[model samples]
Target: MKTARIIDILPQCYSLFLPPFFKNPIPIESAATCRNCAMLEKPDSHVHAPKFFSAKTKCCTHHPDIPNYLVGALMNSDDPEHETGRQRMLNRIAGKTSISPLGVFRPKKFTLLSRNSNLEYFGRSEFLRCPFHDDEGFCTVMPYWDAVCSTWFCKHDAGEEGWRFWRTLRTYLENLQKILSRYVLLKMDFKPSISGLSIDVSAPLTLQELDDLPPPEPIYRKSWGAWAGNETEFYKQAYTLIRQLSQDEFARIEGIEQKLLLRELEQAYGLLTTTPLPERLKKNPELNIEKISESSYLLSGYSPFDPLKISKRLYDCLDFFDGSLTNQQVIRLCHDQHEVGLPEEILKKLHRFRILIAVGETK
Candidate 1:
């Protein structure tokens, strides 16, 4: 069974908040097979995926906010293979482009463009491509990837349920990243100015502002406070501070909203991992069926992105589950009348994916 521990869910810098008991792996969605490129067009691809992404930039377009501790983790990695990524980090720091005491960020112009433009540019635009993405289409800083990079997936095995779990987890982790990075700065006695580098994004950008220039030196220096020139060392120190935090210390630092989010995340995770079949089943009234071939139909509606392919013979048997009979009775009826045996596992998947619904449940 494919699984990921709680520790595996986020970058190592955030591991101080996770309990030791959660190190045990439990079942979760399968990792995205990046090499195979699920979003790309393929002759044998079963899912009706759009050929929107090029192999060179398969959803590696967005700039992620690498928190200070994670930046330190990337720099301090002992793995010889991480040398290239580490050097890239040094280059970004030395360039004084997007580097801030909080960590690396997207330039204001790119951030403005992303806010204003349609999402059509997300996976196709080179302007928004991540610097950590190498020429070979591999992530250079995989081990110390930020929360956003860690939680994103193009597809989910548990369909909408899986998506919900990941979405909640992403929000929780993002919030934690912000809170904890600030906490690290405070712990280091560096009082980062909150209003030092404000951008007025309410108005449309002028052509000059769209030049994607780095922040002015004075403002950047003020934002970094005492850690302006010593960013690398400060980040390393931030990593050490966060690494030493006990679970109780983390809990004390986290707010009520974070606690609520963590609870929601736990509930979502439970729903994703557990598949409970109802006693009676019925075909979802809202399903959209497309005739792919004479013998096959694509069933969608639970999630538009993850469609299930069903045989025409099985499609015809959907009416047998009209909430009038038990699941076993419907299974028997299908087999006796149409010579189609409905396996328990397939039924569970169909129900889990919402192709089949519980008799009285509203989707």
Candidate 2:
């Protein structure tokens, strides 16, 4: 009922009603309003452009009227009628003074969620903003945003050091952001096959064993990618307590991730930005990050995170070598998976591509 900000999660090429790879021929207006919904102004933007009205917009497809989502994602719990039942931010936040030693050894409880609970939340599958945020000013969960939320604040608020309890929050967030930034922006190639259409990759995880990776305490887990399918893959889907990336942080993280990927392989150990990249690259047999960087900009580059250049180098390397390895194969080899075996999730990807030439899968 409150005016909340929301974005439309429209599929890029494929639509159930439209043809595959069919783009929106109509241009979006200055307000970023879809042309499909140009006529209708009231609550129902549908009566105007009925043709492209998608269920996702929660109204007409052509005339999309998405409510702006100002807050972060959340999961609702039943009202806290009992004294003990309550919801806390579920992340392993690094600061605070609320809990004592005895509290550490205890379990926290939350109640069942209903359509209308005290808490307003989104789907648990992927990360999103909490629905309880009042569009006008403050967040409903401010007092109880929990440890992680309490700790993180950005350079935007230059003078205000968040919480004062943890000055190191920014550093930790930066490190985690570096790792998250890489995978979070990785665009997946979404090919539509009828087989996986109705399958639910985001199942409500239930566990019989309490200790065996039980469901994340509702508000605790970072969520992202509630927007699925083809186009959404190209965007940042990873949900975290603090979502925005400072310009410097984004650049720094990219560089670090590139270094990390290159360093994981034994061949790229001596790579230095100063060393002649070509000379250094020629010596290393595989996954030479130095070579990739040198060749791309003639050894005149500085950022550790260059996916385009790296992917190009990977392709070029794959082309030159007469060996039987594919691009994905080189990636797997770079990961040092032989010692620890391929992870099940990665194994699924390999199987999908039919690139599992190496034997051995865990049962």
Winner by lDDT: 1
**lDDT measured at residue 191 in model 1 versus the true structure, 0 to 100:** 61
lDDT of 1 at 218: 74
- List residue ranges in candidate 1 displaced over 4 A: 46-49, 115-118, 195-209, 285-288, 320-326, 359-363
Q: Indicate the residue-level lDDT of 297 in model 2.
A: 16
| Whole-model alpha-carbon lDDT for candidate 2 | 0.25
Error of 2 at 205 (Å): 4.4
> Evaluated with TM-score, which candidate comes out highest?
1
Worst 10 residues of 2 by lDDT: 61-70
lDDT of 1 at 266: 78
Model 2 misplacement above 4 A: 1-28, 31-249, 255-363
Task: For residue 307, give model 2's deviation from the true position in Å.
Answer: 36
Looking at model 1, residue 76 earns an lDDT score of: 82
- In TM-score terms, candidate 2 sits at 0.18
Q: Write the per-residue lDDT of candidate 1 for residues 206-272, one digit (tens) a residue.
A: 5444655545777667777767788899889888888888899988988888888888987887777
Write down the TM-score of every candidate. 0.87, 0.18
